[model samples]
Target: MKLKTEVEPRIDADERGYGGVCRNNLARSRGETHFYGRCGPSRRFFACSAIMLLATGLAFAARPSRPSPLPNFVLVVADGLRPDELGTRAVPTPALDQLAAQGIRFTQAYAGAPVDAASRAAIMTGQHTGHGRVRSELQVPLAPEDVTLAEVLRSVGYRSAAVGIWGLGWEGTTGLPTAQGFNEFLGCLDLVHGRDDQPAFLWRNEVPFVLKGNPGPAAAASAFEWMLRGATNFIRINEDHPFFLYFAPHLPGSSSELGAVRIPTASPFTNQTWTPSQRIRATRIAYLDEQVGKLVADLRKRNLDSETLVIVTSTASSDAANEMTEASKPRATPLSESNLRVPLIAWWPGKIAGGRTNNRPVAAWDIVPTLAQLANAPLPKQLDGRSFSALLLSQPPPTNSTRFYWEGHAGGLSQAGRIGQWKGVRALGKPSVAVYDLEVDPTESHDLAPTRRDLVAQFEALFAENSRTWSPPADGAVGAAGRPGYPIPTNVITQPLRTNSPPDGPATP
Candidate 1:
């Protein structure tokens, strides 16, 4: 038997977004001839094939090119990080500063709550504390039915992972990352464990791995390093696919004591003239900056930098009392600018224009919708946040409403609302409300409420409406006291890898 073959032309879009031609083989087993016009000779056949190839190339050139792949999201939430504390003259955060220079920095970013757990819940659910399931650090567990950013992204083929501090709930709880949406969960789940450096146990998906170490200041640094390794590994493993990596590092927060703070002893700030507490806090912040640099460098090394959207923000502002001298401490009431205003930096090379600063007030809840938009995922209708993804692209941000509301019940029923330049605060058991013109009094020293009753009334009404609109769930207290030890079955833990199916999606492969 004789074999016959013809060159088939294939054209595709090259990296330059232009058409390129290549040859493929079209073969037949037996001697079969197909011709057009007169019976074609070998030279005529070659000529006809070349003409057809040219036409195919022209057709491909006229067709529209495929769109770029969805960008990967890396949300790095630094616990208790204040905007002033970052890239400041006192403590230079070169990594964060570089990120701010490369991306738009929201100078007026506010957390949904003034505390950790509620703020993180709001961030994940895209709802403010008024509407979120959890409103306090350890009072309410995130309801299983609540939709999380990970669940939304996972539904659209994104592999979601949570590394580091997840204060939503403990292992085996409905609020656990595995139950919520993450395909993988490697970190502390309980709020108490998150606050400590040497946690008794940390969760790897549904399984808990007991950590063996002395509970010293160095242990916190070591724990942060361990979490960083997990984050980098997840990024490496999911480089080829769209992924959402929630990298929440617990750092710079005061240790169990008032004077004791955990930071690497070898921190460069050891020689500083500041008090030990100040040096320790500054060192912790610098250490976080260094880790961020590492993550960005790794992405660049893997050629994934341009395709990744890296966001750096905080759960809440740092405790100023810990880092500031007694004489220099600003009078920051609960839910004041000092406690609410945190830094938000979004970096995507060539996609987001660099060196831009936005002062428009944005809340942490907005992070969810913004990321959902970037990932090409459907935004959940129940979300209280509007996507600021347009703002990152240098477009005018959506102007649905300029007013934002927040209320904290941990200390007391303290309510705060900001409408454009005016900010109002009403604390429970206080006779009068406090209002400030943030444009002039960013420190919130002067109370404009006494002078500007009109603005105060407007803000008070807004807060009241928000409070009435969303009340805390009746069963919210379930699992409030988080489980401290490992909760995984022995058989499951001993296996190679164990994963539970998320409420809204299948187990991550």
Candidate 2:
């Protein structure tokens, strides 16, 4: 095949411009002839340059553009916080309410377990309590082989800082946040330490950062204030790059003192006529809301609001659930919705549509994969959670399993699952399963297992498919000691946080 163009060679110039002509550079060698067109004068030069520029622009546009920077993630877990405790009737959380209004709220979201360690483990490892290393509230460290969400993000160039309760592992153990892939860690290391609202010292990575005049009602500073500063510092330092900040505040939760909830100051609630317990709880919640508002404000001030995803959820604890008023309690059982259902709010300005609420069920385990997806990172192996990133973008969500499972080992093996609209609870050694139609009875007050054999069978089948018989490591297997680097003379710094009033007295002046 041959293609040919005929050119009538001529030189000419128009009145508006200089010469308009085309010159051919012809070369012949080895029985081959090549012709190149060269432009002449101002008119031809402009035309030729315009064509070349257009071609270059098209070529540049055709190449794949560089991907947008990965998004930042901030997961804030409030210790012992219950949803009902945040309404106008009790405590008002303006900051949290606004965050929910500007983000996607999950109405039927649940924690991975009824207690801290297991639920936190599930969140970190993307495995439910049935599969994760820390399956119960027992003090245990995650196995070294276990992969954490922080580690997953780190693989894709994220710098992680866990500021607050690193419940999964303690000091000198493989479960430490630093060991688990966090670039920085500051706060309480163990559950015992976490319970101390006025702890004399906190852990900064593997070292003891002493709080010289802390844990006192009249102390010049609060431990929480220090931790919040650490969190904001991390954000300021990593503003230019992708990062994950896990801020878990131990507030409105039980303190080491029996029947006591401690906060530095209960001023706003000090004048309220509520009971001491109620006032303390309200103050703590208010305090938390204020701190959260500040943190988010900091992000906005730094111009990181649009690129960051802030998730606010509560860690479900049976003990914490009981801390609420008797009337507010869901049911006598620990697996009840009141105990398991925690607030799940996701906020990403300019990414997720604001003021949207989704009824789709989300568990604690889903967080890992969701963040991984947002970062375009690879999914870690042996994960049980499916990413809900699509839901964030108002797109069709991932196909989540119809059945959700949870187990707790505090007294004995207790299991619970939700299949469609039916919720079932069964003790591992018991023969009978109590089922409730959650669609009708949101509180699980009416048991239908005795009447609905079909639902029971279905629940049994779901349990059979998902249940795993596993146990936590032996007590001595993992090191539970506090930071060993500190001197014995400073052991006084580890005392329980002090309180100004009795359990029944007013929380503040």
Candidate 3:
């Protein structure tokens, strides 16, 4: 759709600040009309004035009414950010806070899983880990047939671009964003390479290009800046068109296997009295926030602020055990409430009401349907997510599923099902289930399974049903095994060293 344009004649104004018939090409094209002082009378001038007014009115009447332009979309997914760390006194994420203030903040938002790939898969395909094609990190690539958010938006005439760490695909794989409906893809393909703080090369679409920089302690910062530049450029180029930008920034998450975490030497927190790991994590968070602020500012400067929907969320929560101060740490003991719950902020000036907070439960899979609804795009027939656009607009919540399901085998095979206030988790090879009342105990600390036999049975039944419907790929599949559940300790450390593998048997719970 074409943008609306208004034509106004520039005229000299009197001391009262009122303007007279301005001279411009618009007027000249109609006819050579002469005017005297404002409101001055002359038979010829009066005739001309009446004709001009009539012509202008007719022109306006003749022009067909254009529909409102579809708003552009910017989906910014931070690597591993917890809800509490965002906009809190300790973390100081001003950019994210400003976004929350400008739009709606979902108090109970969750990732599909407490890991990267599965959560991202849910976000992209609008399906939970059970229904989504890719259930694990790097284990199963997104099949070409799977309908993605980009594909939906592209079908509706939106130009789509993806930047940063795309965990769905690797080099020479069909899972690349370009193949998955993004018009352009600029960043690392695999999660491991993406985790690299100082990678020698990054992929631009299907082609790989070596970066020109000295590999050192500042590599991670440099890589992040590169991705940000690509994102901004995509926005600048597609400013006039309805575009979809999937900007995934790999920050805060450690890529230590490649080298030391690249903490910006000039970070504001560098001089603070914190541990080395804490400082590094803080620097990354601060840097990521700064980039987000810059991107938002750029949108406003380009006059696209009102015509764009900017969402800031994370794939998963942070993995660091003691990253924050003791007082700021979450009280919840279960991974369901702690690691899975993420910060979700949607910002669109004038379109979405500001300073609104939504306490409704939402999951990462919900993003796909939400974006589809906003863009007026068609969704796949089989989808696990329902549009939460209503929540963003302060309207009544959509007819959505109340129960959210998650499954993983990273550390150990485990499944969790949350139905309203109650959450039940069962590990593979475990006979009993652990249950919690999230409403009363925000943390999944108090397991009500032993006392509440009925609740445990209900959760167990729910988990079994969900698993039957959306089981991960069979053992020894082409892709990596789906890592679900919470962040647990693992024996083998993968590159980037982000997630914790589950142990051999049932967990402590």
Candidate 4:
């Protein structure tokens, strides 16, 4: 469908008006994305404003309604999911695979950081950690001065709401979602506060929802129910305005909350004292998936599905659950495709071209910049991730530029950098370096590190470059009390991201 380029219909009257419209059209032919180069937002905003206003006012001489404007943007980021887990191919997820059939399926998408805080920061700030924002927690955050995805969207006419888990800078005060750009925030603050049995205090904007103890499954369910209801209601109230709904569900680990459901003497879970009620954990995942299903269904029920762009991904893997070191057993880090890669399905019906798969490497950091481009919002100055917006239309990203990078793990051992088919890693900040040609080895089984010394060297150089440039946030940058350790801060950028578990691969047939 031909997209509506103009904001509104205009009555052709004067020559100057037509000329202004033509000039704006020429400028617009360039692309709608607002940029932050050497010239700051002031120039960018003026340029964007002049274009939007001119298009809205005198650009349209005829009443030819173009294709519908952007659908309501709904980004769903599920936690702790591996890419292969999604049954999207020969064996597909009836629901998520259905999503792939109805939208674009990204095979090689990765989180900015293996952990939540930095990943979320990258998503919000549209910059790389080297810029010094990814490592900060609630108390020490991405900095209040930083402009976020919410702030950028809010500047536009988009009504926004964030529910589920929001990890980065999740302080009750300035770090809360509200301060970052969301209009309505109904979520908890810390990482481990909320539970199925004893509910954590839910924060509404900055205020915690006054509650007695033990809100239980019902309350958790209620909060989720309220999330869908609130966003649907918001859409109904402001259907004229485009809106963004960010839902990051926090499901219980195989142990954590699930363990509380039953007293375990010696559970199989690696966590010392913490063991997930495996049964409970599985049940809860199913429950959360169903919640996601419900949310999507509700949008359709409200006649808002086709007009919405739904994006689902994880903020990042849980900290405790993801502590896999040689010294530590398989604590489970989802940063690898087996663990870290989350589900990413964008549903925009006719606009997004359903049933197409783009396996090019992409990152969570790209989401903010992409959204800003789509919304015609002005982009922030610092951005590490590039917008793969073209993929939404089945187009290609810039050649030789689909690599992704991340910094995570206890000792920042869980590092990630990808270029084309090649991937580099140094898990848990170890001396071990592994390399794989993802084109051949999606499941990083064989060690190519020794053989491909040149590729490894290239990747190592890249890693060093990113470290210095992106500044992978640490105790130092985020203002922590203790100085972070690099124990062996050798400059080897190209190495395998070491996994705590046995090498990650598909369940052996």
Candidate 5:
């Protein structure tokens, strides 16, 4: 599984006209693509080439005419949502269905990892589990050097806000949403506190805002409703300028008691003949749908419908034992396809064509680059994601050269990789591998690894190429209950302030 390297030929910067500025790394300077290490015969030829190269560079870097304003982005991340339950009889989701009817829906979308924190870290940092900072579900804050999607948007004159579960960091830590790049943040700051549907207090930026009469019948409202209100308020305040809102709601999650649903009530499904868990699941789905509908209606009311792009997707797979009702099929675990696949929908009015279903295999890591491309921002150097903005406009996207990689770090190290139609999975501490052809057998009910030796060798090399060594911190990080233990030295200096000023820098056309 060793890799081979080749040395590239060197050339003079002046000869290549490397002084000309290029907007992004995807575009190269004039005469740099084909003139890597070559030389012309005479001085006359070199003079002619420099003039041509300078003219070509200016043309390539020219701005577009009749440029449009920057579009707004709304990302909705849900927990414990299954892809198969969208159009089923168990739950009615008119709002989500309407959203799918207005934009493109991805059929073969997969999560970055099997757990919550790992999967979210991949999405925020534009790196998969192999190279991301937070690989497992541990309560680790994002290191100071880790850049997020919101930070990328902020660089392009776009204000950013977040509500609901913020799992990457908590209060007084570098992983806090405000410390990362969010202008305003409100909701649960840790995974342990996120489970309670009605907590006594939730973090507003860095301080606690107590919920009146929570954990009792006299409670004013559920945490879910409060998050929804906060999201809408942010949108209204920033309607005059470009913005990015991250709304992550914990819905239809597993309860503290085994085999039950985590919800406040079951009013919508009270008269049904289903089990108590089924009733609670249905009610939770209904509430989530209503909130989505309200968000869309608010955008239309403010005349911002055509200027915003709303993306609705799940964070990870549902818990089969507790979250899944009688409608869903048997779920899988430990890097199985069922555990990684989830729903992905994008809605943009008068921008993207509607009623189209895409089958391109996209993972959670692709989110950061996609938003950066849409905002016309510069991408970082160490990213593993390829942007799919062309796919949204009904055009072929940039071809991805690397295979998709995922790993689970809960019990022990497990690995999985996918290339074209072939998919491979290796269990924890097992020597054997299971391969499946996703084109013919999407369910992966049958195994073909016993007969495909060539594929096995390919996977072995792919796994070796994608993996990187990770070392966990000893102590002085955030504890399990969202308490700050001690401060670790890093490069970032963050100020958690509340202001309405727009992001610095003029908007790029």
Candidate 6:
């Protein structure tokens, strides 16, 4: 599971056109990058170099030529749900907890970039700062030119489909699950009505579904059953070929008040009421867990579970970056540590032991690469993430790995990279920097900027690297949560196209 060494070869300044650029790894460029329209010779030269590096990494590698399609992999994301919040006597997420036990649970897993669309974009495209895009309400798409996990995997003979949120890209055009790689797309393409609104039906391609967002408990249960039916249908119809199922459940923070709960089934609900904040969430989670368990059971019943690799994660933490002091803001909706830490679990029976945890720093961006590795598909060069296939195989932990970086495109928030024992952070809107001995202060309580001169210098270099790649908040912009349901709100859903999937709930627990 060794990471392939990237060619960081240096060509002559003359040959590389690298002349007269701040020599010796300049920490910070004096001024901002000139716009493409206002570029000079040196600016053009450096820009060309960056493009070359990007091109080299993003090249679509050879696809499998033989008749054998790759193994089917499922990636599930529980939005806004934090890793810590699960399975505690506090939350009792038995299903998620069980998945964590079977898979290598990363203690320091992070969102590629905080927020859904952007972080999800990072996961799909495998590009670090370069692929960061907004997918909240107003959608920004992954550039059509970029290589995607689905695209590459599809090329290698796998049938790929996406369920749940495809928040990136405004419409189903450039940023759609199908366009990227999925052959079929299901679930809510995007959510606006607090996860219980309409669009509320399934969309095969761009066709609108009849089912409204399952605001009622009955609808949720039925919809999930429909999904399982879909999966079962898929397996029955195409059992001969391998397929990738990206199932994203639409159950969000608030579960009870959103809609009707009593569903028609062998098992019926007793008109139960769930409180909004925590209780409702628990109910929603439990229901979703049941659906997952059912899906797994079906797979096992059909002898398909062992052949599938199930990976579940969330786009961001459930809490607000800044605690939800603002009533307009939901309880958990910010970039704070509480709000950004997400759940990531991988389950491959007989491969991943039922109860092992690997607290390495993993991120959503790693999904593309890790999936590619698991399926033995081609790895594109442009991916900024490294696969944790070793951990999935229950191997001993590595002593060290890549430094996870975070920057808030919407919040102007920036952070330090994590080495084994230390961490560093910087202000995105300003030039201030801070460093911490992570071993000593995992909470990042104190800013040792003033006292540790050497640490500051060390971190300054790291921060500079982050800024070059990540785009800061677009000047001054407020996010889309303020304007619910507008197709093109501030950031998440603003592409020129438009497509919406149905919102749904189910007896997932």
What's the CA RMSD for each of the models? 13.6, 18.3, 14.9, 15.7, 14.8, 17.2
Candidate 6 error regions (>4 Å): 1-69, 129-131, 135-138, 170-172, 197-200, 212-225, 254-275, 318-335, 396-400, 411-416, 428-430, 469-509
- Residue pairs with colliding backbones in model 5 are none
lDDT of 4 by residue, 248-303 (tens): 65653334434354211122333434223333443444455566676677676566
Q: Residue-wise lDDT of candidate 3 within 184-296, one digit each (tens)? A: 77677767667665656666666555544525556333566666666675665456568889999786674232234564446677677877767777777887898799789
Which has the greatest lDDT?
Answer: 2
- The runs of at least 3 residues in candidate 4 whose Cα sits more than 4 Å from the true structure, single-residue gaps closed, are 1-70, 88-94, 136-139, 170-172, 195-200, 212-222, 252-254, 260-276, 317-335, 412-414, 428-433, 469-509
User: Candidate 6 lDDT, tens digit per residue, 84-115?
Assistant: 56676644567767777766677767776656
Per-residue accuracy of model 5 over 352-451 as CA lDDT, tens digit each: 8999999888888888889898889878777888887888877876776438998777667888999888898887888777888988997687889889
lDDT for every model? 0.70, 0.72, 0.69, 0.55, 0.70, 0.55
What is the TM-score of each predicted model, taking all chains together?
0.78, 0.79, 0.77, 0.69, 0.78, 0.70
Q: What lDDT score goes with residue 46 in model 6?
A: 68
CA displacement after TM-score superposition, residue 9 of candidate 1 (Å)? 37
Number of the top TM-score candidate: 2
Query: Better model by lDDT, 1 or 3?
Result: 1
In candidate 1, which residue pairs get closer than 3 Å at backbone N, Cα or C atoms, i.e. clash?
A: none
Window of ten residues with lowest summed lDDT in model 4: 31-40
Measured with C-alpha atoms, the lDDT of residue 76 in candidate 3 is: 91
Clashing pairs in 3: 139-479, 139-480, 332-443, 408-484, 410-502, 411-501, 411-502, 412-502
By summed lDDT, the worst window of 10 consecutive residues in model 6 runs over: 30-39
Q: For each candidate, how many residue pairs have backbone atoms clashing (under 3 Å)?
A: 0, 1, 8, 32, 0, 51
